[model samples]
Target: MARTSNMLKAAMALVLCYPLAIAESEDDFWEYDVRVSEGYCVYRNKTFAAYVDYTLEEPCEKWNCYPDDQMVLEQHCPPPPGYEIPSNASKDAWPYCCSNSTSS
Candidate 1:
């Protein structure tokens, strides 16, 4: 009886931890770098004017530059639950082709 109880506890713990694991994995996919000097933001050896919004195609991220020499980063997260990607979808396209529709 104790063995069965322990096994149930173990299963309950795993179920509770599953969402945390998913959240961590999603957070790990993003990369951030911010450098501000002379009222501008520098990224990848390039300088961006203040109050400008720019995008990076390689990783499909959007960056917003603020006059205070601060930058905000936003990227496409994983598709919603139950969404399905077509077989011929292009991974290089990122958010655009990452997912299509829910499995039916």
Candidate 2:
């Protein structure tokens, strides 16, 4: 009887935790970004909103600066949708890294 009770308990535990695991996968990569350090949202030309990094300085996220124009790109992680690492992107103003608010 004890053995049967333990098995039933184990099965119940797995069943209860299954949904929680599924919900976690919904966001997947983006989910973790939310936890990154909070900062102001950088706007891309007062229209499009660019991506956010967990830092205070410009090129807030991990990126490579193009000494000339001063543009940056996701150095470590792959570029997000629409954010293409440009070969000659102007870093004069906001809207950097070819990224916007819609990103991630």
Please give the distance, in angstroms, between residue 56's alpha carbon in candidate 2 and its true position after superposition. Answer: 36
Q: Pick the candidate with the highest lDDT.
A: 1
CA lDDT for candidate 1:
0.46
| Cα lDDT of model 1 by residue, 1-104, tens digit | 86566445533543353333234345423334468789777766767775433544455543444434244333354433433444654555434533442211
Model 2 TM-score on a 0 to 1 scale: 0.19
TM-score of each predicted structure versus truth: 0.37, 0.19
Q: Which whole-number lDDT from 0 to 100 does residue 30 have in model 1?
A: 38
Consecutive 10-residue window with the lowest summed lDDT within model 2: 28-37
How far is 88's C-alpha from truth in model 1 (Å)? 28
- The models' CA-based lDDT, in order, is 0.46, 0.31
Give the Cα-based TM-score of candidate 1 against the true structure.
0.37
